[model samples]
Target: MTGTVLVTYGTTNGSTARIAETIEDVLRKAGLTTEVLAARAVASVEPYDAVVVGGGLYAGRWQKDARRFVRRHSRALAERPVWFFSSGPLDASASERDIPPVPAVRRAMTRLGVREHITFGGCLEDGARGRMAGMILRSGKGGDFRDFAAIEAWAAHVADELGRA
Candidate 1:
C-alpha cells in the first residue's frame, strides 16, 4: 500500500534530526511519500500510515518530547507500524557496547507495542552552538559515532515493512 510515512524526531543538538532526515531520504528514494517533522510539531498522528520516532539520549534517557509523544498517542500508535530509535553513546568503545534503553522508556515502548527499537552512537562537537552541552558531553568522552550504513539499512527495512503492509 502506498501511504504517508511520518518521520518524527527530537534532538538536543540536531544529530537526531539529521538521522530522521536521512531516514526520510532513504524512504523517499524507495518510492515512499515521507514527511519529516519535529516531535513537538506533531499535534496528532491522524495523517500517517506508519511512524518512525527518533531522539537523542541524555543522561541515559531519550529526549522528553519523544517519550511524551509516544505516551500521549500510544493507542493510535498501536494501530500502525511504529519504530523507535535513540542516538547516544558516541562510540563503540568497551564502555559504549550494548547500552540499552532506559527502564521507563523501554516499558513505555513495550506497553505501546513499538515494532522496533534501536540505539546508535550519537555525535558531540567541540564548538557547536550547544557549546556548553557539548563541553559537558565531552568532559567524560566525545566522538561522532553514528554509523550511516546501519541507519540506511534500518530505513530500508522500514520501507520494506511499509510496502508489505
Candidate 2:
C-alpha cells in the first residue's frame, strides 16, 4: 500500500505545482516512490498507493481543474491514503478575511478519506496574473511566501506516516 505516492496539483501561475514537486522530493528522500503530475492530466488514481492533491486558490475557490479532478476520482481516491493541500495564501499573517476551504474541497476530503488539509502560503510575482490580486490582498512586498522548510517538514512527516502503512 505504501509503494507509490502520487503528488498531483493544479495551478494557475504554477505555485501549487512547485509545492507538489517539493512534496514529491521529500517523499522520495524518505524512500517512498513518488510521481508528480498535473491534476487535469490525471485520469486515474488506482495505480498509486497514496495521493497528495492540491490546487491554487483564487477568490475563495480552488482551481476548476483540481476540483474536477477530485470529483472525477473521488471514488478511487476513497480507497487509498490521501491528503489535501491548498496553496494560495498571500500573507504570512492570518486574518479574518482569509478564506476557508470551499465546500467542494471539504466534501472531497471526506469522500476521499483524506488524512489532513494543509494551507500553505503562495507566491505573487510581478507581471504574474496575480498582480491585480496582489493589489487586492494588500500584502506588503510581493514575493515568494512559500516556506520550504515547513513544506519539507510536512512532506517528511507524510513520508514517515506512510512508512508505517
Instruction: Output the number of the TM-score-best candidate.
Output: 1
**CA deviation > 4 Å runs, candidate 2:** 94-100, 130-141
**What is candidate 2's lDDT per residue for 21-84, written digit by digit as tens?**
9999999988888999999999788889899998888778888888888888988888988998
Residue 9 CA displacement from its true place in model 1, Å: 0.7
Collision pairs in model 2: none
The window of 10 residues in a row where model 2 has the poorest summed lDDT is 93-102
| Number of the top lDDT candidate | 1
Give the Å shift of residue 157 in candidate 2: 1.0
Reference-based TM-score of each model: 0.89, 0.88
Candidate 1, residue 143: the lDDT equals 66
Each candidate: RMSD:
2.4, 3.0
lDDT of 1 by residue, 33-134 (tens): 999999988999988989999978877778888878887888989888889888877777413465567777688778878888777778877654566567
lDDT of 2: 0.83
